[model samples]
Target: MQILTPFKTITVSLFVLFFLTACSNEEATEQTNNTPVAIESGDECHLCGMVIAEFPGPKGELFEGRKSHVRKFCSTRDLMSWYLQPENRPNTKEIYVHDMSRSDWNSPSDEHMINAREAWFVAGSSMKGAMGPTLASFAQKDAAEKFVTKHGGTVLEFKAITMEILNTGSAMNMGSMHH
Candidate 1:
């Protein structure tokens, strides 16, 4: 075995340190990406600026960027409004919604959230949420159907919710509110 020079030893040590640090950073990033964020009491809706906690219904959140930055919404409708806008549609990693089946509308929390991509939403319900007519998200298809049975709405998946549908519901709700 050859004796190592000081420079070689230092270089080897530095290489090992760099390798370890890179592995650690990758693990940290994975964990952050997989974890869902919570909605705090003072969190405001990105679209309407309403205090999210004040709403007694399902809420929405979008996670974007490498850092997993969150944008909270007072209602599912507002979240859709923001998502449908062309300028706001890039780099979105995940979309979340409060599952009405699991949520305490009186006191909303992160535990109630589910991935909007896989969720079923009840729209055009008689119930008025934070901003106006809002879609209620559910984790299961049966739960969404059950909600519609009691609340009177159409069950729709995330992709099926078109801008026209949203606009029509919003216009109807807004018109009725003033009457």
Candidate 2:
């Protein structure tokens, strides 16, 4: 019989482990792709940037994947508008635009607030010559009240700011997003 060296055994084990890990990852990814991911309450909508509330029952659109009006355009009309005029849409990836329930802009996840919109901003904050829309969103109401109080700005529902309004870089000037 041929003798196997310790180094060879360890190498074999490592290769098996690596192969198993890769397969597991692929399986998980495949399962995710098979089904539409439901947008959860805390997650920001792809279109409106509004945060879904835990008790915001029977409102907004609910697509097969739980898509909604404020979150994903609210309607086929909005979605088509977005697709046709891509430039008009805000950087859905960079900007979030959450409703503020409180003014702190500090601890956002507090339960005291019921439902508020917030804009989670990061990318456009540094854009030059007129920064793009910057935001973070929330589903807590009290949070919105508190946010406007300290930040000193108007509080608007998710529908207030449309893709057109946001594209002008106007909301960026709507007082402070500071908490």
Strongest candidate by lDDT:
1
Q: In model 1, how large is the Cα lDDT of residue 12?
A: 97
TM values, all candidates = 0.80, 0.28
What is the Å distance of residue 31 in model 2 from its true position?
A: 15
**Cα lDDT tens digits for candidate 2, 45-94:** 34555553332211122222212223332222223235335553443221
Best candidate per TM-score, number? 1
lDDT of 1 by residue, 75-125 (tens): 889998888877767767789888888777666567878889899998898
RMSD of 2: 14.7
Candidate 2 stretches greater than 4 Å from native = 1-133, 170-179
Q: Each prediction's Cα lDDT score?
A: 0.85, 0.37
lDDT of residue 154 for candidate 1: 98
Give the Å shift of residue 85 in candidate 2.
5.3
lDDT of 1 at 90: 79
lDDT of 2 at 139: 56
